[model samples]
Target chain A: MREGTGLPAVDLGTTEMLEPGTALLIPTETSGYQEDIGLFRAETGSYYALDDECPHEVASLSEGWIEGEEIECPLHSSRFCLPDGRVLCLPAVRDARTHRIEVREDRVLLYPGTAATRT
Target chain B: MSIESILVIGGGLAGFTVAQNLRARGYAGALSIIDPAGIPYDRPPLSKAYLLGQKDTAGIALAPAEWYAEHRVELIRGTVRKLDTEYLGVELADGRRVHADRLVLATGGSPRPLPIPGGDLETVLALRNKEDADVLREKTTPGMRLVIVGAGLIGAEVASSARTLGAEVTLIDPVDPPLVPAVGQALARRLHAMHLDAGITLVHGTPVDISKTTHGHSLILDDGRSIDCDEVLVGIGIVPNTALAQAAGLETENGMLVDENQRTSNPLIYAVGDMARTRNPDGSLERRGEHWEYAMNTGATAAAAILEQELPVHGASWFWSDRHGTHVEGVGDMNGVGATVLRLAGEDPIAAFHLAEDGRMLGAASIDGGLTIRAARRIIDRGIIVPPESLADPGIALKKLAR
Candidate 1:
C-alpha cells in the first residue's frame, strides 16, 4: 500500500451524484484537486477508489478513462481492474493500491490503505 | 491423436505464453520446455532498470521456479541443436533427443552484428539477452564515453539509460528524423529534440569505420564526422535464428514461415516470437513481428490451435518503448493504414490516430498517451468509424465511439 497522509476517511458525495463511467478527483489538502485519490463509478454501478497516481508513471487516474470494470491511465494507458486494483497490462508490473469505499444513504465514504472492510 | 506430449524450445516470453495459455485453457498434456537459459525471464528491462543496476537478474523471471513445478511443466536447460521434424523431436547440444507429439520453435533472435572495420573489438557490444546486458551494465559508468550506432528502440533506450548514469552518449543512425517511419515526422522531431535536450549528441549518419583510439575507440561516420568514445554499442537490429528451422526443411523467408494459425510447413511443428513470419489475413507473408506482444499473441495463437479451441479474435498489433522516462507506444499497422490525425497537439504526450479512407480507425501512436492508443486499438480491431472531430476532442471518450 502507498504511504498515505493517514488522513481520516472523508465523505465524498452521493451515489446518484457520481454516475457510471465517472471519476472524481480528491486531493490530500483542500487547496485544489492536484489528485490524491480517484473515486470511480463503474458502469456496473460499483464504486471503487484508488490512489490517483498511476503506479507506472505520474499520471492521475482521475484524468483517465473508465472502461467497464477497469481504469486506463491517461498517460501510459496501463489498465487496472476495479476493486482489486490489479494491473491488467504491461509497463505497470505492480498493482495499484485500492482503497475501501462505502455508500451511506446517498453519501460515499472512502477509507485509505488496503483494508476494504465494512465498518 | 490429441497432443499427449509437447516440447517447447525456448524459455522466453513466447515459450512461456504458449505453455501457460495452454494450461489455462485446460491442456492436461505432458509439457516440457528446452531453454538455453535456466530461467524464463523478461528481456525488455535489460536496457532499463536491469542495466542501471536498479533491478537484479532474479527480479526479471517471468514466474518463480515453484510455479513451473506446480503446473507440472518440465523445464530443461539445454540448447536445441537441430529440429528433427521427421520424429517431431529436438536434438539437444548434449546429444539428448527429446520427442514430442507437437513441437514449437521459439528460438527468438540475436542482435545483428556491425560488419565494419574494428567491429569485433572487445569493447564493442550488443545487447540481446541477460548475459549481454550484464556486460553492458558493467561498462555504463559515470564519464564513460558511449557511441551508439543506431537510433532505433534498443539504441535509443541504451542511450537513455547510459545518459541517466552520467555517461556521455553519442547516438548515430543513417535515418534522418529518427523513428519517423514508425511514429511519423512530427513525433519523431519531438523525440529527436528530447534526445538533444538531454545532452545526447544525435548524429544522422551511418558508421563507416570503427578503429581503436588512445581513449577507447573512434567511429567514423559516412558524413566524414569522427567521434572518439570509450565503447561502441551497436543496436542496429536483429536477425532471427532460422538455422534450426531451415535444417528441418521448414519454409523460411524473413523468418520461419507460418500460417495464420502459427503452423509451420509441418503440421506437427509451430513457430512463434521473433522467429515466426506469419501469413497475413490477405494471404501474404508477414514480416516477423519481434516485439513482446507479438510473441505473446503468436504463442497464444499456437496454443489455441493446438488445443482445437476457438481462436480468440486478434486485436491490433501493439508495442511499447520507454526512453527518457516516457512511455511511447504504437498500435496497429501505421504504414499500411490510411491518413493519420493528430489527437493531441504540441509536445509530451502527443497522440495520433490513423484512419482508413472510409473513416474507420486503423491504428494509433502516442508518447505518454497509452490510454488514447488503447482506445484507438479497439477502434481499429472492431473497425469502428469515429468522427474526426470527436476523436480530436480530448474530452470525448474514444472507447464510447466503439459501439
Candidate 2:
C-alpha cells in the first residue's frame, strides 16, 4: 500500500530506492507526455525527478551522472540544471521535464502531474 | 562611453549568439546583424541530420524569426564589401555605409578549395553554408558514387550520411589515421573501423588532380590510383575570412588578432569566432578555434566585455561529431598532452580519459559516453586529482570528484 501526500503517487518499493548520487529510471505517465522518469537522490537527502530522455538524442538520462545540481546525459554531453530543468550545455536545445517527488512513510513517491519545481 | 548602437557583421551562430546574449544581459542598445544569408541557422547538422533527411531546415534555426523582432535586434540580409574602421561602420555592396558605436566581427570561415585542376567542376562541391548543403541534398541519391577529399569531422559525417542515403562513399586522406591528431589513436581506430563496417571505402593517398568526365569526375591520387565518382566533396579545411580585418588595417597573421576579451587592435572594434585568432589569458598566442562552442564562447565574452563585466573563463575545448550512428565527443587536448590514457568501464558505450602525470585529468574522448566527458571537463578545469584506479572503476561516479 502507498500513501499519497495530496498528490498522485507511485510506490517505488521501500527498499529499492537508489542511493544518493545515483538515479533510477521509473516509467510513469505525465499529463502532457508519457515516458520514463529519472528519479535522483542528492547527497543532501533531497529528491529530484526529471524526464528520462535526453532532448538532444533521446538517450536515457537515468544513465547520466549527476553533479551538484546538474545532470549530464550519457549519449552526448548535453547537461541540464536540476529541479528547474534548465539547459546548461549544447547539443541539447530543449529542457527536460521536472516532476515532483516525495518520500512517504519509507517509500519513494513520485507525483508526475504536479508543476515543475524550479531550483 | 556607452555603446548606443552595435553592429555585428555575420549572421551565423557567433553573430546570432552575440545579439541574443547582449539582450539577455540587459543591453538596451540598438543591435543589428548583417550577413549574406537570409536566415541565421546552426551549421552542425548540415553534414549529418539535415543531409540525411533526419532533420529539416527549420530544426536548425537558432531562434525563431519572431525572436529577433521581440528582442529588437535587426536582422539584415546583405553582404559587406568593406569595413570602415574610422567611422566604426561597414560598407555594404549596395553602397550603404552603416555606422555603429561598436562593431563585432563574426564572419566565421569559408571552406578551403582543393588545390588541383578541375577541382571547381560542377560535380565537385564543398559544404560550408546552407546553399552548399542544399546542393548536396539534391545530388545525394541511391547508387551514386561519392568521393570525399578529406577525412576530417565534416567529411566523415558526410560519408556517414551519404552511406545512409544508399550512396557508395570513398574517403581519401593523406594521413594513415585521419582523426589521430584530434581524438587520439584508440578512438580514431574505433571510428576508422566504424566507417569500414558501414561500407565506406577508406583510401590513404593525396589527391593530385581532378579530371572531369562525361559521367562525372575522376580524382587522381599520388599513389597512382584514380577514384571515379559522380560527386566530389572537398572537406579539406577552412580559411578564415580575414580580408575585411586586413583591409581595415587591423593586425592579422593566421587570423585577425584579438585578446582573451575578444578585443582587436582598436578598442571600439572586436573580433570573435573562426576569423579571430585569440591570445591566451597571459598574452600568449593561440590559433583560431574552428569549433562551434568557440564561436558561442567568444560571442558571450565579447558581450560581457562590452558591458564592462568580468570575462568568463573558458574550460576545456570541446567538439563532437556523429558517425555511423555513434556520437563522439572530444574535450581538452586530445594530443594526449603527455598524459596516460585510461579507458573507463561501460559495456554498451565506452570512454577514454587522459590523465596527466600529476593526476589531473587532461582530456577525454568517448563513444556514447558524453556524461563521462562532461564530468571529465570539470575535473580538468578544476585540476582535480583522482586516482587512476578510481577513474577506471564503474562504481565511482566521476562527478563526485569535482567536490
For model 2 chain B, give the 10-residue run with minimal summed lDDT: B340-349
Kindly report which residue stretches of model 1 are placed more than 4 angstroms away from their true locations once superposed: A1-10, A24-38, A50-65, A72-80, A85-98, A114-119, B280-283, B343-349, B390-403
**Backbone clashes in each candidate structure, one number apiece?**
1, 0
**TM-score per model for chain B alone?**
0.95, 0.96
* Model 1 vs. true fold: TM: 0.89
lDDT of 1 at B34: 90
Clashing pairs in 2: none
Query: Which candidate number has the best lDDT?
Result: 1
* Candidate of highest DockQ: 2
